[model samples]
Target: MDQIIELFRHLINPAWIIDNGGLYLLIAIIFAETGLFVGFFLPGDSLLFLAGFYGNELSASFHDAPFVVLMLLIAVAGVLGNMVGFWFGRKSGPMLYNRKDTFFFKKKHLHQAHDFYEKYGGGAIFFARFLPIIRTFAPIVAGIVGMDRKKFMFFNLIGSFAWVFSMMLAGYFLGKKFPGLKDHLELIVIGLVVVTTFPVLFKLLFGKAKGPIKTEAAKATEESESK
Candidate 1:
């Protein structure tokens, strides 16, 4: 048990991550986190930042335009990861919808999710990439709601590019300019977590004070029922 715990600890440690698997492990984690439901606990934003911080070493084998290569590889992994999530969600969505509502489940919520995705799916996919936990599930939810494949792909590509490049490049440039910056990686990681997490918590806690806004689909359903 102790050995397993310690191994898990090292996996989350950014410095340890860079030292051990370097680029490939980083890529794999990104893929897993974005696609696999089980990867929500893995360190993502901080890992990308640190990968950029250690770009010189990680990118060494590439020789020419190493930073660009590193960013593209990571971005592609992210895109593929989201695609996997979407596939899983799509495969399982019908089962979820067909299942009888229990004490913990309600069909209305599913309809609401469908409506919400129809309206804001694109923006959610784009922005969720920056928010931990949320990013992992957003694509899956998009799949559940039957979001248009072409639309999902368009945003997936753009969002993955934006998220990977922004986080990694920020670290790369900062590390280049300040040689001693990595000394404060712990503080930076904490800040990234807080920044990404707080908004999600706030939205969940307070965004519903006014109650659920009636969506057009809900209204249409109501009208049909009345008829």
Candidate 2:
């Protein structure tokens, strides 16, 4: 935990990156976090926030490297990451569906994502990007479902930009105003995750109740047609 927190702090410090290796590390982390399924556990939101927070720090310290540039780089990384993830999904679609057990595949997770996609369509792609664990699986499931490529791309771009921009901006403003936020950032992040996930939870519960109702209605329609 301490190591992770330190890493976050380092990323936000600016000098840690610019003086050390530069934007390459930032770009690689962003790409891996979004594009690779194994990267679902990576700190996407926090990393963006830290990037922004560090931007503030760097601007004050070095008086160079504007925040807008940092935002642009992160945004581009996120967009490209989603594109890579989409292509990965498309390539692995058959293997994902046909084989239940693969080297790193979990059928239950795949089914859950598929169900969410079915209920929400492309909107799920955008919405899921905000919801931690689900975000990683959403795109892959969309590929498996063979969602329209153009439609998926539109939603993917929107979600990528929105997620990266909102978190980074929040980090910049919040970190500047309340230095204490830097202390308890993890808890705040968890709270954000919970809040974002509420709608999905509600939909899952309500959907169960409505399922039988829809089934009965369908049966009634069939009987009426027979008559």
Runs in model 2 deviating more than 4 A are 1-22, 58-63, 97-105, 186-227
- Candidate 1's C-alpha runs over 4 A off are 1-12, 61-65, 94-119, 204-227
Location of the lowest summed lDDT over 10 successive residues in candidate 1? 207-216
TM-score of each: 0.77, 0.70
**Clashing residue pairs in candidate 1, if any?**
none
TM-score of 1: 0.77
Per model, how many backbone clashes are there?
A: 0, 0
List model 1 lDDT by residue over 155-207, tens digit each.
99999999999999988898999979678877887788788878756655554
lDDT of 1 at 185: 75
lDDT of 2 by residue, 25-132 (tens): 777777776666766656566567666665666444435668777677777887777777778777776565566554335555555666777779899888877775
